[model samples]
Target: MRDRPQSDTRERIITAADRLFREIGYQKTTVADIARTLGMSPANVYRFFSSKKAINEAVTARCTAEIRMRLEAVAASGRPAAERMRALLLTAHQSVLELGVTDAKMQEMIAVAMAESWGVIRAHIEEVDAIITRVLRDGVASGEFVPSDPEVTGPCIRAAMMRFCHPGLLTQCHDIPRPTVEQQADFILSALGHHARS
Candidate 1:
């Protein structure tokens, strides 16, 4: 029971860190800022996380977990390969929009994650790609899809989806409707040589 409070505090700290990193960005958000956001003292915050970098890592883990959860859901749906791929891409794109990109702080955290937390980011990418690869491979094996190297195709598909999902990239392509999650999924399917289902 005593451990429950500690766990709650830790969760609160992580949540605060995630929000602040998205709002102000990792580079500018201080430990104090997170502490204040949590209505706690800096020292109390330190008890939860030793440094801003640590908090940033926690935030990254949380974000990666969220992504994995969504990907897993699509994979478990037992849909056709094209449908699964579309679901995966659209879900990812919606996540980006829901998370929003207007926060300079969040952008900084992502930038830092790309550079400093490459291992963590790479692991997340691999996890997501693995799901897509499995779907593609399963489709081929079941004679639902053409034979292809999933190892290569998965990453390429992910790259294309990422470009469409990225905040920076989306902003640049603002002319596009930004589409609903379903629409984005259909678009990805179309791009991958699959006809969109009615």
Candidate 2:
């Protein structure tokens, strides 16, 4: 019989790692723990990933990919740029809030991911910036936004929404009377000249 494909094995490893990370926190989860979950030796898992860090990166990628799918859908929708922008931010903030509120362990995992600057997390941020850039670019083309450099403007939007976008901040602000996503979106829209700025 042929052996399992490498991709299949790798995905299995990532899936198991994600569960363990959610259960035990990234700091406590081990390669051996992941291997045991798969009923394999740590050496076998190593054939697919070099270190525990790699496993964590894969898990992080998986989580962020889910968020990207939603953002991409919002970007591709036919709604007006202003509505799309609002949807994008709301979708992003909601994803993190849903995950954080539903899974308490996820916040711990996010803290570790942030502390280590995981490759997947960095890539996720860049992709998110790209999505924002796409919306801003379209808005400018449609005369809904003031013309500006999307490269510059996208990061600015990300920075302005940092409180709503950052996972750690989202969790901490859960109890506070923070601005709603719509309110933040309106401020961003105003800055984009969606309304007259005095």
Candidate 3:
């Protein structure tokens, strides 16, 4: 079909851009570099992505997709809210750490995302919040947690876990070693009114 090549070309562009970002950092990698790597013209790259920012957004979305899928799986599971919430938090933290964002070049890309293409990062955070909200609502319905406003708690919980979840902060705070991921997840669960079994 005609659509398959276009999809493949777009994926190829995203793949090349991600590689360059890992090799040379996001601030330094150019569309021309991506095109050169693909043996395609800059105009062809533009046809798929209108600008370098577009390419950067695509690459970022691709990188974060795996983490999102992991979180989504935990959210959609049929476990009790308290257990699901704990698993979701743990999954979120572990998945982000596994993403290798602390690497110098990956950190550079994250820094650029924070500065230039914040919408992409914000979308990811929003997705996380939505998953948390879904779990919290189920927790309330199941009587596993107290009735509370998920909208308020969702982002609050996410902010509380930012040190573990945020790529940039994760690297900076890894050395302090005070509140481990397990402790934080338990703290957040307790704060949500989950009483651990004896």
Candidate 4:
């Protein structure tokens, strides 16, 4: 029960920061602004978050949590491995685009978050890779895909789709044409000696 208020205070700070980030670019939003919006002193906000960086990390984590949830859902599904992989890739790409691509303000916020909260971002990527590795391991067990090292292949797969899955890459490649999701999935499945679903 003691933890509840602390949790709520953190949530309130995050909520205020998120609003400020959206209204004003992250570069322009300060800790004081967040505190002011919350009707609290900057010192009070600091009591909850050690610094602006910590607040940024918390906000960034919240943003990426959406994508992680989507990927976890696809990974946990009863669908075939190839199908799940395909869905996971598509879902991840879509989530990145939704969170950072279409909105200019959001893109700026994401770029800052990526730079400021790199450790958090890297951990999120590893979490995502673990989920993919699980699907690949299951695929091998089911004979749906060729026997290969999921631990090795997961990062490779992520690399190949980085342009689609990475927020910065998504924005960078916006005006450029790239392989469709089906095409990429097919290429991966064929490389693994399995037929990709249509």
Candidate 5:
């Protein structure tokens, strides 16, 4: 019963941190800011999270979970491989753009994660890759996609999508619209020399 308040406090801290990270970015936000947002003291915030980096990691994990959920939903839909792949790319593209453009805090948090929280970023990438690999394998087994090594194909597809989805890359290449999932799917199919639609 005593643990209940501690659990609530932890959750409140995490929630406040997530919202601030999405709004003001990780680099710009301080522990005091989060504590103020939660109507608590900076010392109280420290009791839950020792450092700003720790809070960033928690926020990143939450965001990555959301991304995985969205991807899983798309994968679970009874769509063809080509359509599913396209949907995945579009969804990822939109997510990145939304994070970078509309959610400045999230973009800053991502930058920090890439620079300081590499382990967290790497783990998230691996999880996302595993999901994509499973989806590709399922598509092949169901005869919706051609035989291809998901181990190789999954990482390659992810890398390509990451390049297009990267905020810095997109900013530099603003004149060019990011490729649709259909275009990326076609490229992958051509590389595999198999009809993803069939």
Candidate 6:
């Protein structure tokens, strides 16, 4: 019989690693732990991943991929661009919120991912920015937004919504109740030169 596919083994490693990260967190979880979960030796795990950090990066990528899929559907929807944009921003905030930032174990995992797996996180940010840019361009084309440079405007929207999107900020700012994600989305929509229906 043919040996197991390398990609299958790699995905198994990532799936096991993600479950472990959620259970024990990034700092406490180790290669040995992941290997044992897979009923393999640590040396076997090493054959697929160079280090725990690499495994963590894969796990981070998987989590962010969840958000990306939702954002993509929002961006591609047939609704007016401004409305889609509002939905997109709120969707992003909700997606990150669903990642269990309140759980101490998941919180520690997020903190470590932000600190150690920054490149993976940064790529996720860049992809999100691209999605925002797409909506900006769509709004401009439809006269729903003022003509502006999307490259600059995209990141600005991301920065403006950082409180909702960032893991720590969601927890830290939860007590301050003035501006909900809906309010922020409206503010962003207005800033895009959109006038909501009366």
Mind giving the per-residue lDDT tens digits that candidate 1 earns over 1-198?
Answer: 466998799889999888877767677778889889889999998898888877777777788788779878988897887767777787777777666653556666777777777788778888888988888787777766667788988887788676566667765666766665466566656655565557
Residue clash pairs of candidate 2 = none
TM-score of each: 0.81, 0.89, 0.93, 0.91, 0.83, 0.93
- All candidates in order of TM-score, best leading: 6, 3, 4, 2, 5, 1
On the 0 to 100 scale, the lDDT of residue 38 in model 5 is 84
Error of 1 at 103 (Å): 3.6
Cα lDDT tens digits for candidate 2, 1-198: 657788899999999998888888777888999999899999999999998877777777777898899999999999999889989988988876766533667877777676675667788989999999999999999999999999999989988887887887776776777587778888998888897346
Q: Which candidate is the best by lDDT?
A: 6
Candidate 5 on 18-93: residue-level lDDT in tens?
Answer: 7777777666778999999888999998888889888777767777777778888888898876667767767877
Tell me model 6's lDDT, rounded to 2 decimals: 0.91
- Report the lDDT of model 1 for residue 60: 79
Q: Which parts of model 3 have CA positions greater than 4 angstroms off?
A: 1-3
Q: Which ten residues in a row have the lowest lDDT in candidate 6?
A: 189-198
**Cα lDDT of model 3 by residue, 80-170, tens digit:** 8888999999999888887788899999887877788888888998988999999999998888888889999999999999999889899
Ranked by lDDT, the better of candidates 2 and 5 is 2
The whole-model C-alpha lDDT of candidate 5 against the native structure comes to: 0.75
Better of 1 and 6 by lDDT: 6
lDDT values of the candidates?
0.76, 0.85, 0.89, 0.83, 0.75, 0.91
Q: How many backbone clashes does candidate 3 have?
A: 0
lDDT ranking of the models: 6, 3, 2, 4, 1, 5
For model 4 the TM-score comes to 0.91
Superior candidate under TM-score, 5 versus 6: 6
Give the worst 10-residue stretch by lDDT in candidate 1: 188-197
